[model samples]
Target: MLAIAEYVVRGALSGAIYALLAVPMSLMFVTVRTIDFAVGAYALIAAAVCWSVGGALGLAAGLGAAMACAAFMAIIFLALKRLGCEDHIIYALASFGLATALASLVLWWWGTQAFVRDAFSDPWSVGGIRLAPQGVINFALILLLVGALHLLIQHTSLGRMMRAAAANQTGAALASIPVQGIQVGTYLAGGLLGGLAGLLVLYSAGLDFTAPLGLTLSGFGAAIIFGIGSPLRGFFGGLAMGIAQALAAGYASAMVAGMVPFLFVLLVLTTSRFGEEALAGGRP
Candidate 1:
């Protein structure tokens, strides 16, 4: 029981990073009706850059690289829009292509080396359960950032604009809202959040060049597990996924542990009305 408790605690902390990654997915889905499949690529690039450079400047450089990649995605998005591409699947595919390209770029540039960094030398004891200081920091930072995002989405005029744009892009455009600009901003925000998640992961479990697709799928699972309608839901979903995976890792095979997120996604899609709504083009 004690061991299980520890797993749960650790899982929650790790899940916070997934929640951060999911935020951009939720925001972009709501605003643009598409998934930014390149989000994980953004994280991977950030980690790769940070690993190569090392130190505080590496962090900045990593984030900059991630955001630059996002800017490139934004340009692709805008170009697609300009070309009169209205299919959300096309957007998703485009992002997937970008993700693949970025992964290849990382592999070509950095090889298959794993990106990792140790931020703390000791674990902190909290309520008799040992926890990594870095994990605690990650959890706290996620809480604050998620809270801020909730506030931004629910209270501010910018949030209102985002919601308006999501609810009806045509109407928002008629209302003189810069829908494209808002979408571009959302992409940039995705980059920031994805890059931050990469840094957190680098300092936690580490990852390799092959991690981008897995990371993207994990974030997507987290985003949709509780319905991608809100960031708060995505936050909880991430925690749920983390806990499930942690429990599996503790008691089951490693392969089973890895399959947890995908299983959750499958379960959600089969049992929830959210999947139906998404397919029918209804707002989640």
Candidate 2:
């Protein structure tokens, strides 16, 4: 049916945005073996800064905020390393607290007001389907960036060093790889991706203090479903999540739609061994 086609298209667009947001988290997890619970806050603060300043200046401000947030996370990670803490749960606890604190700070600074910015104000029509220009731009730009990042990781010397460090920090150090530097670089790269996603989210939806958590959840779920080991899979997972959520909203209820992403994740976890193996970064 035409309705089904429409849902699929719209969902895919939204899903692409989610994929972008998820990529940073996935990148961190896969490369650094770290989870930045504050990934969403980076996006929120960037968007807020962009809206407050407006124009190109606002965009720069937004990105800067994201970088700053990433720096803060990197500092935390560095501190943990200094203390000889390599346990992931410890990092998770620290990241959770960091996320909460950063979110609170953003709220204190920006207040709870939602911002609506004009983005891709044009709509493109294709064979009776209406699509927002911003949405298309979001999808295209994100994929391009993701692809570039992928190439950097797959083909570059720095990327190989990072991957080597990720696979075994001690071994990497023994192999003459700069493990500490690689860790810092990974965190910074993750932050950059997070900031970029935030800018895109601002264009897609009005920026809000609470936007980060939802974005984080969507991205986290997508990454988990697709296997954090494979960034490409994370992108596809987000697309699938978006399509399912769209269908749920169109055919069921808005509340149900909101729950659809997690439900789909649950379904994947229960029925698909691939999801688990992928989470573990093993071949499916």
Candidate 3:
């Protein structure tokens, strides 16, 4: 039982980064009715840049690279819209292309070296369970960001406009709300959040060039686990995913541990209302 508790704690902490990744996914889905497959790429590039640069300047450079990538995605999105491409699948495919391109770029520039960094040399003991300070920091930071996002979405006038845009883009436009601008803003926010997640991962478990697609899928799975309606659900979903993966790793084979997240995604897609609605394109 104690062991189980420890795993849960560790998983929750690690899941914080996943939650950070999920926030952008949820935001993009709600605001633009599309998925940004390049989100994970944003994370990967950030981590790579941070690993190369190091220190405070690296952090800034990492974030800048991520947001710049997202800006490119925004430009593509606008171009698609101008070309009368209203299909959500097209947006997803476009982002997937961008993700692939970014991954290739990373591979070419950084080679196959894994991006990782250690913030602490020793583990901290808490309540009979050992924890990494970096993991705890990731969890705390995610909570702070999520809280701020909730307030931004629920309390502020800008939040109201975002909600209005999400609920009905035409109506929001009729009200003179800048719907496209809001979506562009959401993409930029995704870049910031995704880049942050990458940095956290760099200091925690780290990742490589091949990680972007998997990260994107993990975030998408987390977002839809409870519902993609809000970032709070994404947060919980990320924790659930992390716990499940940790438990799988504890008692199950490495293969099973890896399969845990994809399994959750499959379960949700097959048995949930969100899946049904998604298949039917009801949201759009």
Off by over 4 Å in 2: none
Over 4 Å off, model 3: 253-255, 268-284
Per-residue C-alpha lDDT of model 1 across residues 108-200, encoded as one tens digit per residue: 999988999999999999989989899999999999999999899988989888988988999999999999999999999999999989999
Per candidate, the number of residue pairs that clash is: 0, 0, 0
| Candidate 1 residue spans exceeding 4 A from truth | 253-255, 272-284
**Residue by residue across 1-284, what tens digits does model 3's lDDT show?**
99999888977887777788889988888788888999999999999999999999999999999999999999999999999998988998999999999999999999999999998999999998988899998899899999899778878899888878988999999999999999999989999999999999999999999999989988887887777767887898889888888888897887677887668767876898866754453432
State the weakest 10-residue window (summed lDDT) of model 3: 275-284
How accurate locally, in lDDT, is each candidate?
Answer: 0.89, 0.80, 0.88
lDDT of 1 at 48: 93
- Per-model TM against the reference: 0.94, 0.94, 0.93
Ranking by lDDT: 1, 3, 2
Model 3 residue 244 distance off true place after TM-score fit, in angstroms: 0.5
lDDT of 2 by residue, 158-268 (tens): 877877777888899999998887777777776777877888878877677777778888888888786776678788888989999889989987657677767888889
